[model samples]
Target chain A: MYTMKWIQQDLQQYVQAKAYVDTIIVPLIPFHFSDDASLEKDAFQREVLSVFMRELEKEFSGRILLSPDYHYLKSADKAEEVKRVRSWVEDSWAQPFHHIFFMTVDSSWKKFEQDMNGTLIWLPQIVTESMQFSERQSVVHSQVQQVGEFIRSYWEDDK
Target chain B: MSEDKRPVSRRQFLNYTLTGVGGFMAAGLMVSPLRMAIDPVLQKEAADGDLTNVQLAEGDITNEPQRIDWEIDQVDGWYESKVSKTAWVYKDDNGDIVALSPICKHLGCVVSWEGSEDYPDQFYCPCHDGRYYKDGMNVPGTPPTAGLDIYEHKIKNGMLFLGKAQPREEA
Candidate 1:
């Protein structure tokens, strides 16, 4: 159940074991530096999404490759972002990933979800910034469990 | 200066040379053993000897397996961060505390207690429908090739401290 570490040795093993590792999870992060008001919200979402992805990776480390985060400007056009995300999918396809999922907390991505090449999973915004660590953890844990089940459902369809 | 530089006696010269070489040999012999004796004291483990306080009260553990979550400081190469960990904890028939790693042996998926409705008393992995008995033993003919890992645990004053999870031999 060892996940792929971003190192040469782990990657060499990944290439050797390509049949076992076929799924990829990409986190879509949005940054808004132009407006000070939206900065905190964007930052909060980024943090929450990363935690969610980490938990997901732990759940299915052997079969899934956690790709680097994909960052974009919040003010960027949805059409333009779709093109950029599709480019990423094309590059990822070179590695023979059968399943590619893009996880995001921004609701705006839902409008252009179908235009993207991979599946877009938009999680609801969680306002747990002020909550205690334990409280927020439980919240994230429950959501991550549901998301994991959802991903498994897709894999089941293939079989 | 000339008087002091008078021809050295062979006996004095040999005595000085022998003392210096003997001192060098003794130091070389002692250095290796000294470093070996102090090596453990200089090394610090990422998990502080692999035991982290899980913050669960001893009384809280019951016969039914309960999920426990805890955080530890992990150092990965040059990066340091807090990593969250989870375990399935319960008391066995003999009233002994048992902690098992929830990672499924098949494909690294997380297993849950009674996850599938059909398997009410066993740990189930939703990824490939893998099942394990209550004691963390994988059901025969399942996808998992090995049994679940057991964690080293210690009870201190009412709190439970857990160490690394050691893999179990297949039954």
Candidate 2:
């Protein structure tokens, strides 16, 4: 239920009720289906990441905001990309949000984890063809549940 | 001419009749297994519409909105997955139990109890900042075009059972 989209009326209500929303989640997605062999796998990974993020939002609705996805080029330099990512985090933090979670399947973010101000949750990129639907559901359900628990602890720690 | 007179014996006639009856009896016996295999698919659709127990006691319901999280087994095509569902439950002034779907009507984002700063007693959405009143009604100037949905509920043996939430009538 976490989304950045709202009509004019909803935005007005959000502005007035800013204090109640305390956390914001931003997903960084890298679009890198340049090669033919990896295109399908990459696309599958993207879909999985999307579902996982939605699950997280559903788990902690009202407490967190699901902002627009952060799309970046696969060929881009990770070092330079950190600045752009930091900017997005800063912009979202301007609100009274006490927690900002960066959800990503990109391995590049691993290096920038310490540099970034927010918490970086880097999920291992999955090979979609290797797993069946039922297996994937179980794998996703368990891992996503753990991630939810981790983020929950942060909120709990605050209290 | 010879073939026409081949089954004239009484014993031969009885054998033919016995074989014919056996085939029909075997098919009749198969009907029970066939029904057993297919009945669940037909009956499941109707039986699942019944309410799910939320494990809350009648005395536990208070005026303040309390979030309840539970999972339900959902069958989609070939896979059976447990989908998590959430609801906000509380008691109104008249002491009636009230349950509302936390999803925002504006754009399907999850709404929260007292999530907004301005609306202290209202359900607020962080996505577009939608708001709903305490009675699950959409605020006049809020983003939600309709009131929040109320869940079908009943109390059995002091326990609350909740079904799907239906759209409330708008005035």
Candidate 3:
């Protein structure tokens, strides 16, 4: 059910079962090649966000379609980017996704959250590299659980 | 020394040479197919590494399904990483232990035991409202086309060891 790796056969399946798949998860990732200091942080966020997205997809694969990552420059203007982001959500409506979510670890996206068409979920970035392996896993696991609950709450709101 | 040096007739030479070459060709032909036939047994032994000890003891499982998490090392192409897996374990009416994979059959979402207030005593998937029975059978008219997967399990030393979850055929 993960749309991240789209094959023709899966696409056909999705098309046939389009009514059941109502949710879409769009991961917003920022890349920074401008400075050495910001580069490492951006890279870490990308990896962590990927892990989070993968887990979330696994949790809600039946009802959700994971979009190919939406990458933007780290230094880009959020106000200007809102238009493109909203356009992406609008395009997804062609597939008729009811609940579109933009998941990101970047806090700056919070400013334009209201401007975006879908729900803009901002998660705090975790510096997992320095943390112990098990500790980092536990942290990510708990966060994923919380996020799963949050998504469920949205579904509950509809009923 | 004299007997060893004796010159063989052309027929004897042909016989020995043909036998040596034929043996080499026959061995080369048979080895690959032989390995292919035995390969599954070898892989099964390797797959035994998948059996993991879930911390909960055999005595602790109740009628209510409990979620169990365990870490396993997964090697996916290049990256070797630790992946956490989950299973819902409980004792059935007949007092036999059962473990089910949470992944929904319709579109692969995770289902929770008695998740929805409306659907009591049933596993519910929040995604598309898929439902499964207590025995992991998919409820008809629900989103799920097949039943939930059942994990292969064994009890040793009073501890539960679970292997992979095998998917059930359409119900």
Highest TM-score against the true fold, candidate: 3
Second chain TM-score, each model: 0.75, 0.70, 0.77
Interface RMSD of 2: 6.4
Worst 10 residues of 3 chain A by lDDT: A1-10
Q: Which ten residues in a row are the worst by lDDT in model 1 chain B?
A: B40-49
> What is candidate 3's lDDT per residue for A19-42, written digit by digit as tens?
877788889999878899777767
Each candidate structure's TM-score, on Cα atoms with residue i matched to residue i, is 0.78, 0.52, 0.80
Indicate the worst ten consecutive residues by lDDT in candidate 3 chain B. Answer: B1-10
DockQ of all candidate complexes: 0.42, 0.12, 0.49
**For residues A1-159, could you state the per-residue lDDT of candidate 2 as single tens digits?**
334333465456556556656777788888875788877777777899888887767645545667778899877998888888888888777868888888888887898888787999988865366888777766887787688768767865775
lDDT of every predicted structure (CA atoms): 0.85, 0.78, 0.85
Docking class of 2: incorrect
- Greater DockQ among 1 and 2 belongs to 1
Positional deviation of residue B134's Cα in model 3 after best superposition, in angstroms: 1.7
DockQ-better candidate, 2 vs 3: 3
Q: How far is A129's C-alpha from truth in model 3 (Å)?
A: 3.2
Where does candidate 1 clash, by residue pair?
Answer: none
Q: Candidate 3: which docking quality band? A: acceptable
